[model samples]
Target chain A: MAQVLSLHAAERRQLAAWACDAYPHEACGLMLGVSEADGVRVLEVRRARNLNVERARDRYDIDPADYLAAEREATARGCELVGVWHTHPDHPARPSPTDLALAWPGWSYVIAAVTAAGMTELRAWRLNGGHQFDEESIEEADPS
Target chain B: MSHIVIRIPTPLRGHTAGADEVPVEARSVGEALARLGELHPGILERVLDGDGQPRQFVNIFLGSGNVRALDGMNTPVRDGDVLAIIPAVAGGGHESGGCKTESPSGTDYRA
Candidate 1:
C-alpha cells in the first residue's frame, strides 16, 4: 500500500531532460505542488542551482537563497514547496545512504537516473514509518 | 551587543517557540548561537553535537554565504546581519506521500 505521486507527462520529460543535460554532475530542483491523502499532484518544477561542485556526480547542495526564494514563490503561488529532486548520473533511481541520512520527513523526493544511454528512469520515494525508504508509484497524466 | 537576526528554517521552528526569525545581540556566531540556546532550551543540541561542534549535516549561513566557508563558528557578526540554520534535507520519494516523520538522525520533526 504505497503512496502515489501524480505528475504531468510534460513535467516528467522536463525533469528527465534537465537530468540528462546535467550529466556527470547532479542537477537539483524544487517541486511545487499540492499534497493530499490520495496522492501528490506536481504543478510545477523549479530548477535550482547545485552548488556542491566537489560531488556533483552523486551529491547536490541547493543554494540556501534559492531554496528560500522557491519557498516564498511557492507560498505566493498558493502551493507548497513539496520536496526536492536530484539527478544521479550512472546510478539507479534509488535513495542512497547519504540521501537517507540527510532526509527530512513529509516532503516528496523524486530522483532521476541518467546514464550514458540518456535518462533511463525516474522514480519517487518516501520515508516510511520504519525510517526506511519505500517506493511510491508515479502516475503521469497526459499532456494537454 | 550587536543586534542580529537568526533565520530558523521550518524544521527547526518548533525549537524557537515557533519563531521564524529570532533577534539577538552577540559579537560572534558562537555567541549568537549560545544566546539562542538560552532563549530556547534544547536548540543548541540540535545544531551542535556533544563535542560543541556543529553537526556535519547542519549548514549555517551568514547572509548569502556559508559560515563554514568563512570562519566556522568564529565568524564575526555585526549589526543587521542575518544568520540562517538549514539542516540537510532528504527522504521524500513521493510527491505527496505522507512520510511526516523525523529525520534518520532522530531529530524531532513534530511540526
Candidate 2:
C-alpha cells in the first residue's frame, strides 16, 4: 500500500479559498515546502493565470518565465515544488482520467471543488510509481 | 442522430449555465462541437482554433486517452461516449527553491 502525504488544515483551507476565487477556469498554483512525519506544511500560495487557450478545458500553461521564477523561488526556500493544485469548478473534487495521465509519479496532486453555492472542498492525492492514486487526508493544525 | 456526451468544466459552465455535462451528436469531434455551438453559441470559439482544430492548450480525451495522440479533432465518438476537455498544467518553479524546510525533524527535504 502506498502512503499518501497529509496536509495541514490551514493549508487546505487556504487552497480552497483560492480555488473558489478562480472558479469556472481551473485555478493553477504551486505548493511549497516539504512533507514531514507530522504532515505537509505550506509556506506560501501564489496564483497564476490559466494559459489554456481552450477556455473550458483542463489543459493549462503557466508562462515560461513565471514557471522558471517559481522554480527558483522554491529552490531558494529549500523546498521542493511539492505539488500542483487546481480546481474543478462544478465537478467533484476528484482526479479525472486526463489528470491521471499527465501526473508525474511520486508527486502530490491537489484538487479543489466548488459548488454552485460557492462552497469549497479540497482533497489531495499521491501518484505512485505504478501510476496509481492514493488519497491523503487533511487535518487542522494547532496554532503554535 | 448519434448522441455524444460532452463534459464541461467549471470555467466554461457559463456557456452552458453551470451544467456539468451536455449531450450533442455529430459525425466527428468538430461536427459535434458545431452542434454544440448551435445549441450554445460562442462556445466553439473558446475550444477551437481558426482552422477548427482544438486550441493548443486544450486537450480532448476520448475515454482515457488524449485525442491528440490519436487523431486530433478528427477523433470520432460513438453514442454515449464521453469526451473530456482538459487544459494543460502551468506554473511551477524550476530551480533555486529546493523542497527542504524547517520542521521538527530538523529539516524535511523534498524534490
Candidate 3:
C-alpha cells in the first residue's frame, strides 16, 4: 500500500506562510512526526535556513546544524524527524531529478509551489519499490 | 574501546531496524561505524562509500559539531559521547536559468 502524509490544517498554513515569505527564493524546512502504520503524522514543521545563496531562486540546501537541532527537538517531543520540505518558487511541486537522486527510500518529501499569489499547491512524495518517487497521499489530520 | 551513543537519522533508521540510537563500543569514529555496519547490514554503504569516506550526502556529527570540521572519520570517540548521522538536504534548479540542471543522469523535471 502507498504511504500517506497526515498533517494538520494549521500546519499546512504554516507551510504556505513560509513559502510565501521566502517569495522568489526557495524556502526549506523539516517535518517532525511519528511514523504511523499507514504513513507519517507530522506534528511540527520547523524552518531550515537555505544555505544556497548563489542560486537562491531555484536551489536550496538545508543547514545541517539546523537538522541536528530539529532532530533533538523531535526526540524531546517523542517524535522523529520524518521528512524534508521545501518550496518551488514558481516551479511545480514535483520531485526534480536532483531531488530524487538525493532522497532516501523511507522519508516523506514535501514540495510546495509558491507564486506571487502565494502557495498554489503542496504535494508529498516517497521513494517506491523502484527506488523512484511516487506521489503519496496527504490526509488532513482530524481536529481533536 | 569507548562505549558511545550513535544517533541514527530518520532515513537510515530502517537500516538500523528502527532503532534511533545504537550503543557501540569503539575507539574511533571509523570503528564505531564499522561496528554499526556489522550489526545493521545495509547501513555502512549508505553512510560511507568505497573510499572509506562518508558518502557525499551523509554527514557524521559529534555532538553539535560536524565531523568534517573535526577529523573526518578518524575522529576519536570517548565513552558516553554522542554521534549523529545527518544526510545533506540539497537540490536546486538549472544554474543555466534557461536549462534544467543536469545530474549524472536522471529525468529533468523541468524538461
Give the top-scoring candidate (DockQ).
Answer: 3
Q: What is the C-alpha lDDT of each candidate?
A: 0.76, 0.61, 0.85
For lDDT, candidate 1 versus 3, the one ahead is: 3
Tell me the spans in candidate 2 whose CA falls farther than 4 Å from its real position: A1-10, A37-39, B1-111
After best superposition, candidate 2 residue A21: deviation in angstroms? 2.0
Model 3: residues >4 Å from true position, as ranges? B93-111
Cα lDDT tens digits, model 2, B18-45, are 5646888777777777888888887676
Q: First chain TM-score in every candidate?
A: 0.95, 0.82, 0.97
What docking grade does candidate 2 earn? incorrect
Backbone clash count, each prediction separately: 8, 27, 0
> How accurate locally is residue A80 in candidate 3, as Cα lDDT from 0 to 100?
90
Put down candidate 2 lDDT per residue, A1-144, tens digits, no spaces.
434445566666677777667666667776766656544655655666666666533445554334334545675786655567777777777876556544544346777777556636777777654656678765555555
Instruction: Please state every model's RMSD to the true fold in angstroms.
Output: 6.8, 18.9, 3.0
Model 1 misplacement above 4 A: A1-8, A33-43, A51-55, A63-80, A139-144, B1-4, B13-27, B38-40, B74-80, B89-111
Which 10 consecutive positions of candidate 3 chain A have the poorest summed lDDT? Answer: A96-105
TM-scores, each model vs. reference: 0.70, 0.52, 0.91
Descending-TM-score candidate ranking: 3, 1, 2
